[model samples]
Target: MRPARLSVVTATTVAVAALATVTGCTAKSDSTAGDGAVQVIAKDDACEVSKTEFPSGHVELAVENKGSKVTEVYLLFPDDRIVTERENIGPGTKAKITAEVKAGSYEIACKPGMKGKGIRQKVTVTGGTAAKRSPEMDAAVAAYRTYVQEQADETLPKVKVFTDAVRAGNIEAAKKAYAPSRIGWERTEPVAESFGDIDPKVDTRADGLEAGQKWTGWHRLEKELWQDKKLGADAKTLADELDKDLLDWQKRVGRAEITPTSMANGAKELLDEVASGKVTGEEERYSHTDLVDFKANVEGAEKSFELLKPVAQKNEPALVTELDKQFAALNTLLDKYRDGADSYEFTSYEKVTKAQRKELSDGVNALAEPLSKLAAAVVK
Candidate 1:
């Protein structure tokens, strides 16, 4: 889960929110434009677009934040479905988003504090269809869909185990099942988050709660099991709620919108998840299972990269090589904390030193730089 707190970015900014994983978007500081990309200038209260109408096809939005606060820019369908977005764009920074657009009416929203229903601007995509995809790209999309469904299928039973222990008032058993229960969800979070409504119910942390919003999710139960050190009637009831929410997720996984660029963008989003929450020790404050979640994020990112490697190799061989090198390096570093060769058990995040966390953070940044270009490469 992403923290509600915003971090300042110095050079370049990548998306940190789960909803930002929808389409092809890359975060960069420089606004170098030679290609036909629309310029979007975002101020604290106003959002200005270079053009409101463009032909429907491969559309690109170069977003520049002139605002004082960290901002988020979204390409939304009329119904507010996020087609693509770039979040955590710090003051004076820039980001670029490339999306597959069909002829339709849409909105451009600029959210200054990264909160509320943002300032909206109407945009119309006139006539041509979204560019046709190659069979290889179609195969990639289909494979990724199956992979997401598999993760959802695997997650249900694990979550059931944890919830059953909670319902039975077995604190020790529940604690044992906690981290393992979250592995599948953490791995494919962007896909689950695409549903929008499901995420806050199942994963919202106390600090991340909105105004007047009740805190009821895994983290709430996490606080009870670890911080309070006891399970009560409320905890039992929450376990049931959590189970019901996840069951809904399982039923809806098949309907999620999946695209080749979305997969690549999503891989980078998982790394952003690590940098924002897992490495900071904020995600698992009560349980200290941050390492388990950290490893799962990397694994998930690697899965997407690996699936798209064939197309990426054909288009950007150098990028594939560098990604290969960096992914191996990061995995090697993570392996240092594993309890066994094939085990999910990891050294608690509390035991990891500050210096070690920095090393891990550096490793993530190293890989993220190249992985950020994956979407552009695949679309080539």
Candidate 2:
């Protein structure tokens, strides 16, 4: 998920090189005989292709593996369409791919090492039968459409419940509601994991607190601010710090052009804030009220995703379907906490308990997994 943090190691470099090769293409060696013929080569640990434009119809792609490692190539069309795919092209191997296509734009993606950071080549198809359509393509389109509809029907209402519980300050209910909420955002784990260390200091507090007072992560922060009365000024200060940090985080998260390095830096910064006690102040007191509000914000995000899913799916089925899965997981995780918060009544933060904190952490992780995946899937 999140493209595995884009390491600078040989493996990661090779993968990125491949991706760069495929995605960055320019027209080369144009000819009438080569009109319908496209040549793809994997070179310098990347996939490279000749001919950026062609007339649509029956097309043949001559792909040569020039890289040391084996690679697989996929021809993906605009709007999440996959025309055809070939796999297991060993070094020095060459393969020919034939498919009936129409005038449009398509991408050549190469998968190396069985991982997704593949090379993509852009191709433009011109001058073909305007009405030529295939039954198989139609079927795939229909199936994708149905999958998106089902996802929306199943996940939206549950997301609302989880968010409502968090906004209500019902920590017990929030815990219980987190499970279903997690499922709703399962596909967006990469994004959520970036915020995983929202409040790491709570681990120690959770271990030291009474059976019902233990709290961790966001839940721990909530208890510190709203449940624990001993931390007055400290809690307020921590809340202010969190507000600032979260605002910065929101800006980074909302940006359309986020690089793996930028994402990693953001995560490190958040973790550092928690480790330095900047989020909770010198007294190390957490804030329950702040936690509730943060959770609510997370819930609102889920709702926004639910609304966007349909439109995205209609425009890009394959991509949006994957994204929906991530959102589903996130929604499920939130549902667990919401349910937990609703099922129990805690008069004080001390009554929150260790088991609850553990559950909340696990739920958050579950949600984080999918968000991370979605981010990685679209990073390029």
Candidate 3:
């Protein structure tokens, strides 16, 4: 099952601040450090921020997880729309988060177990004009929006094919459709996640569900087809529900908020997803189709980086060069698992050795480090 990206409401104003982050990607300092960054200490029960307020424009959060469990920290708008977030911070580790916020009221939430609403701390951003972005950045955002829309458009029909097989009780056919159905969704997950209500209804895993939430969507059907080896009484109903939910996603995707920073940040989020779930073999435990999802995530990240390359190369040529090299290295590694150059057919994840997994993890981390800085580079 995938690590579910939280859905968010439309926050007309905070759209510009959607600088998503992952562990080890953000930087800031304050009294305890330097560089005008706010300090965040995340404990098992308490979340502490060094400052309750700061100026608008660029802000950094320096987060240290003192908790035993892995934690996630988020910057959220008043209605809890996520402005930016960093996930998968291990115990005793520190990470930095950078965001571009307009003057407004916000909250910092730290989820110790990386679940639920989390502990919230109110924050205020003092008045300042919004950052004036380069035309290239605007062009990148426009292009990314188009890309996201195209992905959404392409995903719905594939999902329908999978659902149709399920409703027909053809387990083998449904299994065949599963991995292909997810490619488009995997490629633009963050955009689907921003709808505030759609993702949980469609892509959520069994473990990722909240209290009172029903088990539905792709994973639920996957379990019935692969693990149970028979159609559950509810299988057809679940398939219909999955089809309906993804239809909702296809309709609502074009309205999602998009920004240059969001595109860059989202690219990093995809890498983080691969590192956390796909490489670990947690996302597709039943089908062992993790490699297909891994490829899609990398493709998504690469698309975003390519769109913003012109501006990022100008601001940090060395970073862009390193990013290109790492991406090539990772793609070459992935190609080894595929049936052919253009096929999604891959060796099952269960057949992969521990060493191979580690190598994949290392490659993702390598690419992620440079991708993490893409948002800051483009916005500059």
Clash pairs, model 3 backbone: 1-283, 8-196, 26-96, 26-97, 27-96, 29-37
In order, candidate lDDTs are 0.81, 0.43, 0.81
Clashes of 1: 0
**TM-score of each candidate structure, all chains considered together:** 0.88, 0.33, 0.89
Where does model 2 exceed 4 Å of error? 1-39, 44-46, 57-101, 105-121, 130-140, 166-179, 182-380
Question: Which candidate order results from sorting by TM-score in descending order?
Answer: 3, 1, 2
Residue-by-residue lDDT tens digits, candidate 1, 180-290: 999989989878776666787889888877666677879998999999999866987899899999999988989887777778877887998898789999999999999
lDDT of 1 at 268: 83
The better candidate by lDDT, 1 or 2, is: 1
TM-score: model 3 vs. ground truth? 0.89
Indicate which candidate wins on TM-score.
3
Point out the higher-scoring one by TM-score: 1 or 3: 3
